[model samples]
Target: MKNTYFLKAVFTLILCGFFSMTYAGTIYLSATGNDSNNGLSMGTAVKSFSVAQGLAADGDTIMVSGLIDFVNDPGNTATTTTSGPSTTNKVGIVITKNLNIQGTSSDTDGFQGVDTQTFINTRFIQLTADFTLGLKNLKLINGALITDLTTVAAGGGAILMTNGAIVAENVVFDSNTTSGHSAISGGAIYIGGSNGSGKATSFKNCVFNANEGTKGGPIYIQSVGNGGKITFEGCAITNNLANGTTGGSAFYIRFNAPTGKPEINIINCTIRGNKVTANNANGGAINWSAKTPNTAYVNIVNSTITENTTGGSSTAGAGIYFAFGTNATGNYGNLTVSNCIVEGNKTDAGVASDMQVKADAATGTAPENTVGYIAVKNSMIGAVTSLAANVPTANITDATYYNYITTLTPDLKAMLVRNNPDDLKVRYYTLGDGSPAITFGKSTFLSPITTDQLGKTRPSTTDISAGSVEKNPVLGLRKNLDSAILVYRNANNQITVENSTNDYTGSITVYNTLGQVVAKTAATGARTTIEKSLNAGVYIVRLNTTAGSAAKKVIIN
Candidate 1:
């Protein structure tokens, strides 16, 4: 029995050693190949990223040196290379595992993978299985092509992360292309599961810039079947253009309905300078949605969204458009935007009355607002125009109107709008000093407050809009006026008015709009209630005391 035990232990040691050796395979690729099978050593470097990928296993590493060219055959132009030729192919490298693909320099940026024009017109990186594709300290860019038609079709040029987990650290996605005008496309990085909740993906510390496509010019996440979850952290997505009217510029996450799943979380990211242009395009920095049971959970914390535009025949969010994945009735999903800055997003060409918040139904109609909800707490949100210009005053609680619009023409609205029903409310505090968005909110977000585009703490106590907060206590009533009103609302929407020089023991009189004394009461100790029938309109309520009187407008809706 002792001999048997010893043999077993020895066998286990041998197996561990073998497994470690297999996992330790690190193949290097460069402009020159050593033409040796010993890929574990740098001296025996492989010729291309494809050869390295073929030699790698699940957790292997691929170290790239010098300018390595990858060919992509999106159109299946070559009978020789299923992937692509080393010269003018469609895709350069296809990732199949949780491998670390890295470059030598930290300052330089270029495409870790490249996809060019092709006859078959396929995706740049078509991910068929589940894996983790990591691009470390590299750049991927520019997806454009001129096809048979007179017009040019562009996109689907960067990393494609489908049915798996994708991560890019300090990488850039820039110019590349697949089809011309007729391109079935995505650019930068496209993530999603199979049809029906089968894929999961995420990206961190990445940059997506100057990438163009028909839909999802920079990044697209389409999760079918229960949908999938996509998370972005410490990344910058900017200057990406999505062509056509309906495409989204920077990020477009859409899922199917009913059994659809949602798991979209964006944290500590910067999304700016992206455009969804002309015709039905959504120019927002990020457009995310979940369908039916699949709730698109978008949590943008400690991030900044600015200088993004969305417009054309119809327009929506310049910063973000959060909704239910399903384009069906009453299927609006859920959204939670906390600790972020969404400012400076606008419609095309100086359009007026662009809103910052818009909520509508899926079918591009109206009156099915129950499909989704938005909850924006402890954050800063304001617009170029006054809040009144965004929605009709009567629709504050007009559930029928919101529902009908969201269900009918969800995207046929004006510029820079946010859609958050009563279920999805926005709350935040004020900023200090010279800031535009000081004291400009109905509520205050409370979590790790979002910083500005330059990484400054968004003030939460005294400001109404972004880049503005009132910190000096010396300023009297106007100090954070919007926040003060919100605070009053927090106190059950009841306010007491009094002259600063008055005492509390005087009798107070209340009157109606017809100059009739509706009720009278004594100011007992410090407060008194006005007893009168109040309707849904604004009413001027006056309180009389020994030092004179004070009148204020109270909205009782």
Candidate 2:
């Protein structure tokens, strides 16, 4: 009886110990911390990241100091080569368990309440095992090329995720490169999976700049098996270079799975100024290739792909390239682009300066069985040199509008202007008046997106504009202003105000550009005719309602 009781007590104690280890306490890291400390609190923080890595377990949180050199290991040296890992290198932060590594800032200017200075100047993070990893509020820069020698998975100057889920938010990856030529890819990040396995990765509010690789200068995601999903939201990938024969200067995605197709969702991203500098390079901004019988899906919503170029006889897709394998049986890949602006992209070989979609074979069993398919809706393309049969004409304004009409140039410039070509952050192309892009979008899209790229609500659910910024009503009026009242001038130089909603009790006022009140009328309901015999010129008409007020520019002929 005593033996049984003792055994039960021992088992219970083991379970308790397991739970305690699994729920390990948080570890604090600082530049001035001592490596011999316990690292459980801010006072007893650890100095070296390597020591923290050894002490941390699954579900542990590593709170790094906001100091610039918190994780910038001086002992870690980066290699200049492209194909292999560093020689005199620190093994990096090899994460085998689920962890939350965060950079804490004391700066009041930061958005997250704390001004955490999370910058890593050297070394990279590698996720070798399958688990959930969260990295937030950090900047990774000047990381050397690191690769898995066995799998030939090179690149990832900042991070390499072989098989795991990663959520990276508010991070910046800059000035990282893989210089040599042995299948070097993913200058900033490399996500790889094989044998019917894949990973789910998401990047939110991240910036990748000046990273170089043979393919995917900023990011490379490849899946040899089934089910690889990647989402990049509000990311800026710019000024990256791809020097290999096959392109994707900013991003490369390969869905090589034979059974299930992988998916890539890019929302509100700006991919610009990336270049491909080799022969036969494709997709100066993005290169998507499907090598299996299954179909890979890529959805781009409310984004901008512009100013990317390809050189040295690269024949297609300066902004984007979609290709399918020859041996694929079913539909290989699919691309859905909505509410986007694709402009200023050029290719040296002169195929399509903006985008190119190709198949290994022209003939297929059915329409859905083609090598690849592209669907573009509510978009502005700089040029459409090919794939006219696949591209729809609904709510699509081509470069010809800008090329033919001189008066429309100002409006186009106002709507699609890149304020600064050099910097990616200040890039904004909002809608201006008299632009065909305004109120020309389709009522619905394949994706459930209700907001524009800038997080503004669409004025009309039925008729939204194209590109990232939706056109708001004049003078910050309510969206139902148009529905409430209608104003127009008749043949007798008299202004007619028609209120569709009987509940609208307001006053009508007209003024000229010089702030002089030309006419005024008090509404009594329904139709209110005001005889304002004024000279023929431009005037501003305003309606004041109990709910709100609306203004419109009218020309009296």
Candidate 3:
């Protein structure tokens, strides 16, 4: 019996060692190298990224030493490449197996991942097969896409991902774009292809700037085949343009079928200065259309969406658009806007310019399919609304539909000296001295507050700021802010808000379950109370102060 066990263990070790020996190792690629070389070491590097990809096996590492330039390749013809999407045969590499593309340097500048020196220009990287792709410390610029006249399958100007998982860190996609054709989408990256098992797609510390596309300037996710989670953390999407009328200049996510659960998270990021230049475009930065049988979830937490612009005069959501397509009635979707600063945007959607909720589009989907569920809390925005079942846009009768569109006009640029390092094209909004966003974030709205984008330690729950940029306290309102401003029902059935903090002074409102304000009054001095006779019910008490705004639940007997 002891001899049998020892032989079994020895066999297992031999098998493990054999598998480890069969695993592919590293392959080096350089601009000045030759394809005839072995590509096994730095001295014997290959010239073409495509050649290196063909030579390597699954799980092989491609250590890129020199900038890979596709346009200046030695001898290649018949294939075409452009700065954006086209109907040409794109000259690029097709990734067929699992691999890692690592660059020489991985310098990070907050949301900006690239410096002025390192760059790699490629036409495209088509991932048609199911393979996990890992990219680190690399910049893909001027990547384009190709599509035939009929099929709309060719999207993703730079990285066309359809199957498997993609984990890219410290990567920058700049000036990548697709054509203005009505069928094409995704300027930088496109994720859509029937249940291809794309469950592990996440981008960390990435930057997407100056890209152009038809639907989504930088990204368009049609579907992921099965259950998938797409996340963008500590990233910046800026200065891109969406040429098509279907908006989402920064990102457009559309659900065509309920193939699987699709979730997208935008945490600790900045989406700014994007544009939708089409005549009837909406959602200057993001357009979300759970327009089919989709159970999707979108969480925009601890982010900043500002200065996004839409072209149409009657457009909605300069920062974001909650959309519904034809035949999208019975579908359900959820949006949570927490600890965000979505102000200073350009939109013509009434008083809510920063963000808009419009179930008003009539074409495309059935009228029964255009409604959704949304919650906007503890954020500074231009406007927000609620979502009811089977309704496009309904009255705010419940807590799910909420809005706090203030005219604070927070000083967003160069307000105070931030700890952000200099980048090649990095842009971040720093809250000025006494900016309203500085201690206006609601900690309980989402998760516990920890650090900001630049890795600044935040205060406790009561004193956190709203946007991704956490500011140092000039007044230090990050402690006991709730105790400084109190809102309660008086003995005479009146709503009273006592503000011991001088930074808070604006208005107070009392909303009942039926979405009607039973009482409202201007806030002034130290103690301000609204005299209103009320009955027994639970209500939502909201306070809009100069520094920021907050809401609470109150019960009156």
Instruction: State which candidate has the highest TM-score.
Output: 2
lDDT of 2 by residue, 344-422 (tens): 6777644336666665543233343344656666666665444544443432333322222122231222245555555
Residue range 438-512, candidate 3, lDDT tens digits: 666666653553777666777764657777877643322332244577767898987777788766678877777
Judge candidate 2 against the unseen true structure and give its global Cα lDDT, from 0 to 1.
Answer: 0.66
Ranking by lDDT: 3, 2, 1
Which ten contiguous residues of candidate 2 have the minimum total lDDT?
106-115
lDDT-superior candidate, 1 or 3 = 3
lDDT of 1: 0.50
TM-score-based ranking, best first?
2, 3, 1
Q: RMSD, each candidate, Å? A: 13.0, 7.9, 11.4
Error of 1 at 268 (Å): 2.3
TM-score for all predictions?
Answer: 0.61, 0.72, 0.71
TM-score quality measure for candidate 1: 0.61
Better of 1 and 2 by lDDT: 2
Candidate 1, residue 484: lDDT: 20
Model 1 C-alpha lDDT per residue in residues 1-557, reported as the tens digit of each score: 99999999999999999987765567776546553555666677765566677777777777876645444322223212323332233442455666777877534533333333442322335454666666687755443332333322223565554455665666666654433443335666555455333545556666666777666877666553355566666666767787755556777666554454456777656666777776455436676645445444555654556567777522466666654423443334555565455655667753421223344532222332333555554343434232332333332321211211222332321122222223112111233222322222222432343443234454455332322122221111122222222111114444344333334356644444444555566665434554444445444444444543334345565
Model 2 residue 462 distance off true place after TM-score fit, in angstroms: 3.1
